[model samples]
Every structure is written in structure tokens, then in C-alpha cells.
Target: MENQWLQVSYADLLQATDGFSSANLIGVGSFGSVYKGILECFETVVAVKVLNLLQQGAFKSLAAEWEALRNIRHRNLVKILTVCSSINFNGNDFKALVFEYMPNGSLEKWLHPNVDEQPQLRNLNLTQRLNIAIDVASASSSSFENTNHDLKPGNVLLDDDMVAHVGDFGLARFLSEAAESCSQNQTSTFGIKGSIGYIPPEYGMGGKASKYGDVYSYGILLLKMITGKRPTNDMFKDNQSLHHFAKSAFPEQVMEIIDPRLLQENAEAFLDSENHNNLKNKMRDCLVALVRVGVSCSAESPGERMEMREIAMEMHAVRDLYLEVGIQ
Candidate 1:
């Protein structure tokens, strides 16, 4: 059966976004520009990603995204509404993708809030963070069967309810049949596929993209969410990295490295003596477990990393524990 996707006309999108006006442009990336638009036929809000056909890599990315999105269906994954391929008024080749608009935007902006933004806008509490983590984990685990070569904060979008939806499959690729029979020493033909900070260590040595590499990238993302620090943070000098920094602070010193906003949000709950310090203890335990999972999944050796199945189960358990403790 042909893939179930709407083939929208270029004129409708032009009308929707007022000819892709600058005011409608919401995001710009290596592949294309994303504009906020409302499709009049359906009366629905959508994100229109118009690919830059002039860029050599954009064509491959467009194909990869279409192939991956058409084959996958999961609650935590981004939903594609339609696609457009045609010539523009200027007679230039145009290719675009329309997606369900995510009101809350990317996880990157929320985690590392803009300096000029209001303080109230920057906070993401422990419970919300845990929920987002679970959402991403579920998406990652589901996508492992047809691995996403790129997994990072920028790719994680939040809906109106703050539920995370993993998007951007431009670099995705399924493991080839030959890969299953090849020796471990053989390098991947797909080439290096992830953003700098999230790339797995083995990929540096010409390793192939595998479920393990996705896990490593997810690990880095998890650590970044918890600590409010990117893998490329300046503090990670003298052989230190986000992974090692988080690993070293495990169990005892977790709070020291944890996002201050998270702590501040729950300060009153921690101060409640009637709970008999139960909330505090549960939070600490949850943090320790979460950090351990991050470290284990991002292990320097791909062979040492935990599988997504295990990571998913453990993360769900952690979220359950957090909810059970009633630490709001």
C-alpha cells in the first residue's frame, strides 16, 4: 500500500504562511526553515518545514525523513500531516513537510532558557522533567528497531501539555542485512550522522550507527536535562565531559550538579517536616538511579552500554517511584 500522507499543493502553503514571511518563521536548521502555519482546509495549526533544495545534504535529509516518518507510528514520535514537492513562484524547486504544531517548542530552549526571557518561563520541575525523560525514552526504544541516527535536545519537541515528542528523522537509517553478518571491525557506510556532543565515542573510530550509538546520544541528552549543562559546556575541560561530570556526582553530590531551578521549585516540599523527609529521600534515590542509567548507557565502550529496553524499563520505574512519593 502507498504510504498514507497528504500531498499538499504549494499554493495552499503559500497562502497559509503568507508566502513564508519572516514573521512566520519559527526555526531554522541545517536542513531547512520551519514556519508556523494554519492549513485553511483542515483549519488546523501546523509546522511547515521547507527544505533548502539548493543545499546538497537537504535532498538526502528530506528523503530520509519521509521514509522514516511514513514507516513509524508511536505516541511519543512526531506526527507528519503532509508533504509538498513542486516549483515555487520564483521557479525554484520546493520541498516541504507539514507536521502537527507543537506549542511548547523544542526541549533545548526550555532546558537552557534564553537570558532575556522571564524567570518563570525557565523552570521545569522534577516531575515534568521525569515525564519528558520517559517520553523520550519510550520514543527512542520504539525507534531502535529502525534507529534514529540523530537524538538530541533540539530534536525533542513539547506539545501543549508539555509531553515530549521526538522529531527529526533526516539522518535515520535502518540496519542493513549485511550489517547483521559483518564483523564488528567493519565501519558504517552511512557516515557520521549525529550532532557533535551527542555522537558516540566509537563513531570517532569509524564505527557504524547502531542501537548502541542511539543509546549513547540519549544518555547525553538525559544527563543534560538533569544537570542543565550541555555536553560541550566550557566546564568540561582537562579530560572531563558531561558524562564524567554527571558520573562523578552520582549518589551523594547529585544535588550539587542538578539544575538549581529544579531544586528551587521543590524547596517547600522538601522543607515539609510532616512528610518525615520521605520526599527528599525519594528524590535523591531517583536522581541516583537516573544518573547511573545515563552513565551506563553512555559508557565509553559501546559493548558496555545498556540496551534501550533495559533503559526504558528502568526510566519508567524511576518515574513511578517519583510519582508514588507524592513530591509535588
Candidate 2:
């Protein structure tokens, strides 16, 4: 169905989200909260992203998201349904964006699930992770890079079919050529404009938003997917980073740093396959190619990073070869 923005009332949202109860709160961000709710008008479950207008820059974030998403549509990008801008019962301004609810939740929870709450780690097999990387790359290659300055695992959501959709465009900037040319040294009044570790080196140095910066964040996310480690891990201190950590183990010792869960799955396949040696070699090659792309795209220098188009093409090739191996 074609997506369209509907006029929704604050009272409607209140009922749909059960008065925004703690139970309905699915996720919280720096400027807003997301709640899972049933939208009676659409006859479907939706995510309500309520903006905290009281917070500094919150209105601007909402405006940024609206400007970024209003004209975009892509299979790999999150679908925004409608927006509500009105007064709350408390005589205060209320703003919320309704989005298609994702059943599987964010890639963050899956990558680093809490064992206390989820006894079984939600393991994303090699094939699944590869596909997700491809999906995000596809989204990155789109106009969303006009710039989605925040491309992290937490902003990637999965649907019922496990298709990855990049969302949360609060940090997005729609730039023109003239503006972009002069943006190299421009600083954001909102500070760095991205999560730590995911922010590109150039951005921290007062560079303005750019597609290259998005590519850098995508690179970090891709590496995180393969390694099952956050870029901000305690181990990545004293000048160390996720990029260096992965690059240090590239090609040869990839197996050592890769997520053990992925290795365990491959081990099971090897035990059952008569061509186990060939299978092992192919998997190694696939992983090596992935790491190389991740490392190349996340170079410290923006000029050194891979283009989003090239990254998408490489990920698609990797996923195709992986599926051909009959591992999925």
C-alpha cells in the first residue's frame, strides 16, 4: 500500500498507547520515546515516536526527521506513516511520528542481547547478518544519505521477514551542492550530531554532514555485525577502535575475532557436510571479503572511505555467494 500521512489526534495516540504506559514503551532516544500501539484508523500496529519538546533541540530533531523522510520511499528504509502536531491534555504541545511497527526489534538487541532477560542469545547466522548489511547498504545508497548521520545498529530495525530497515533520521541533513562544499568546516549547533564511536573522524573535527560520513558509520555497523562487538566496547580504549580491532585481525585471524556464535553454526554445518573443507574455505573467503569492505569504508580519512554505491554492490555480491553455498 502507498504510504500517506494522516491527521491523528493526541487523544487517539493516548488511547492507542494505553496512556503511554511504561509497558508500551518499546524504546527511548535522546529526544523522544517510541511506543508500540494499535492504530484503529489504520487497523494495524504502529510505533509512536513521541518527541520531548521540553528537551533542547527536540523540535529541531522532529523537523529534521520530517524533512528527511517525507519524500523518501525504499524497501530498506523505515516507513513513516503519519504525524501528529497538536496540544496535549496538559495544555502543552505534543508531537509524534507514527511508523510501521517492527516485530523483531532493533539489530542492537539481537547483536548484544541481555542474557538475564533473554536466556537464549538471539543469534543472527552468517547469512542473515550478510543480508542485513546489504539492506542497510541499499538504504545508504539512496537519498537518505542526504545525510543520515546516525547509522548504527540501534537505528536498524527488522520486520517479520527479518528484512533490515534503516530508521531514525533525527540527525539527517538535506544539503545542497553549494552548502555541502562549504560544510567541510561548519559545526553543528547541536554538537557532534551522532553517537560516539559511530561518528566519523571528520565529523568530530567540525566537518558538516555528508554522505561520506554516513558511509563511515555504515562501515562501523557492518564490522559490528560480523564481530558482535559494539564500537564503544571497554576494550576499544587507549586509542584503540573497532576499525583497528577488526583490521588487525583481517584475512588471516578473522575466525578468532568473529562472533563465536557464527563459528558454532558453521561448525555444525561442517560436521554434516561431506565437502566440509570446501565449505570452510568459501565461508572464510566470504567473511574476508566482508571485513575488507568494512575496513575500507571506515578509514580514518573521509577521502579514503568507500562510496555507498560500491559498498552496496559488494554486500550484494557477498550475500549471493553465501546463498549459493547452500549454507542458509
Candidate 3:
């Protein structure tokens, strides 16, 4: 494919990233390292993804990301600002892509905050979490035709205003092309392309890339965000998946498994007798609905899983109901 993106010089990127110093490093992935930089010309903060050409699939990933992001436009999707492909100061081939900076980092950090960090920074209220879940569902529903093969918490970024943006399109593929010859019931041979715990069960059985796989991954992500537990957490051993873990808790013990910070933050409001019981019941009902949705979307059978559009709609209703209860 011809490079159609606006290209920036290596020297300029080097300067913007302060010689790619450690301090500027924001994220490290299989393809490359992403650095937070400020473009002198635009005077705007941006994320610069410097490709590690030596990595196994770095070149393909770079091209895939460009192809996936170029034509797509969504509020919840990260915007690519520009591209850079040139010889660096050492004469080595360099390729980088710039994206709009997201100041709030990612969902992973918030869901599983670093113990070493301040306690206040780790808290994500019910409203914020619900909004983020809706944002992700909206993004995935819009891109269902173009399945994001790798959907995980680490790939979901948050802007300064806390709007969730689904990103990392390196493993993205169009289901229309990949599933043309296969029937809905039949599995197609697609190499495993998603993170371990987030991958759909059928994919391990040779299922092809389809919208259902994305739904499964999104389901896992929703569960993770709700419970603050990684799908691959060590506690999930002995064939106890995150789905089962959450399912077992269901409507009653969900609060026990949920992020304590969430409960702690909302505990004060439920101190009154009559109003407190009413609000608590409303909260419980909402939690039940949320977990049910998560379970339905993450069903082991692809045919049993809910569609992205349906998931998005249900999340919106849940959020609306939660808001209606007047809980902060």
C-alpha cells in the first residue's frame, strides 16, 4: 500500500520526544514504544509510536494500524495525527506514527491501580465506569464489521475528560472478508490473534475472525472493569475463568468481588434508613442487570452471545437507570 499519511522527519520526532528518553515513554508493546511528545509546529501534545523494526510482526503491525485507522472516524476511537518514516540520526530506518494524546492513560491503570500510587487516583465511580463501558460498547458496535482481534483493557485509553477511546488496531481485520466462505455455525481457520484470557473460546477451536469474537473479548473487558479483576488473574486457576468467577457471585455477592473502592465511595450515601434501603435495592438491581449483560455477551457459544449493538443498547439503559436512581 502506498503511504498516504503526512510524514514527519526523524530529526523532528527525535527532538519532540527528547531523544526518545525514558521519561517520555508512555507505553511499550510488541510493535514499538509509544512516547508522549509535543510537536513544536503545532504546539500540541501527541503520542508518538516508534516502531521496533526488529520485532517479529512490527512492520505488518505498523501497516495494519495505518490501514485500520486511516479511513475510520469515531469519537471513541483514537485519531492518528501523522506518520514518520525516515532514516534516524544513526542512519537506521525509522518509522513512527503520531496520535492525539490521551492524558488519563488507560482503563487498565484505573481498574487495577498501582498499590504504590495515591489511593485517590485509583477510584473510578459507578458513573464513570458505566460511561466508559458505554463508550467501549459504542466503539465496538460501530466497528463490528471491522473486528478488533485484540480487545483488552490495556487497549482502551481515557482522555483528560474521561471519555474512553478504543485503540490498538494492529490485529484488526474486516469480518466481511475473513468470513465470506464460512457459515455462522462452522469454524474457519484463523490464527489466534487475541490476548490469552480475552480470546473467545471458539477461536481456540479454529474459529475464524468474526464480530462474535470481538463481542466475547468486549464481554471479558466489561467483566474486568466491573470486578477489577484481570481475566488472567492467578485466582482464576482450576478452570475458573473470570466469567465463572463473576457468574458465581451474580446478584448477591457481586459487591464482595467488585472493586472495594467503588463500594467505599458510595457507602456514605446509604446511611439513611428508608431512602438508604431504597437506593441500595436500586443499586443491587442495577448491578444484577450489568452482570447479566456481561455474562450474556461472554457466553462460551458464539451463537449464544449477544450482539454488540444489543450490548451497547443494554449498557445505555443500565446507565440511564443507574443515573435515574440519583446515585453519584
Q: Model 2, range 125-214, lDDT digits (tens) per residue?
A: 998898899899989897646665468998999999999998988754522221344444444323344476787776655566688888
Task: Estimate candidate 1's RMSD in Å.
Answer: 3.6
Considering TM-score, which of the candidate structures 2 and 3 is the better prediction for this target? 2
The residue ranges of model 2 lying beyond 4 angstroms of the native Cα positions read 1-4, 119-121, 174-193
**lDDT of all predictions:** 0.81, 0.83, 0.81
Best by TM-score: 2
**Worst ten in a row by lDDT for model 3:** 185-194
Q: Model 3, range 180-253, lDDT digits (tens) per residue?
A: 45554333333333366877877665456678888988889888877878888899888889999888998678
- What's the TM-score of every candidate structure? 0.91, 0.92, 0.90
Candidate 2 at 310: error in angstroms?
0.6
Judged by TM-score relative to the true structure, which candidate is superior, 1 or 2?
2
- lDDT (tens digit, per residue) of candidate 1 on 1-328: 2567665789989998988999999888777899999888878899999998886568778777877787678889889887898999989899998999999989998998788988677678888889898888888887445556478888899999999998887854422222344454442433333376887877655565678888998899999888889998999889889999988888789879887888788888777758847878888888888899988988999889988878889999999998888877
- Pairs of residues clashing in candidate 3: none
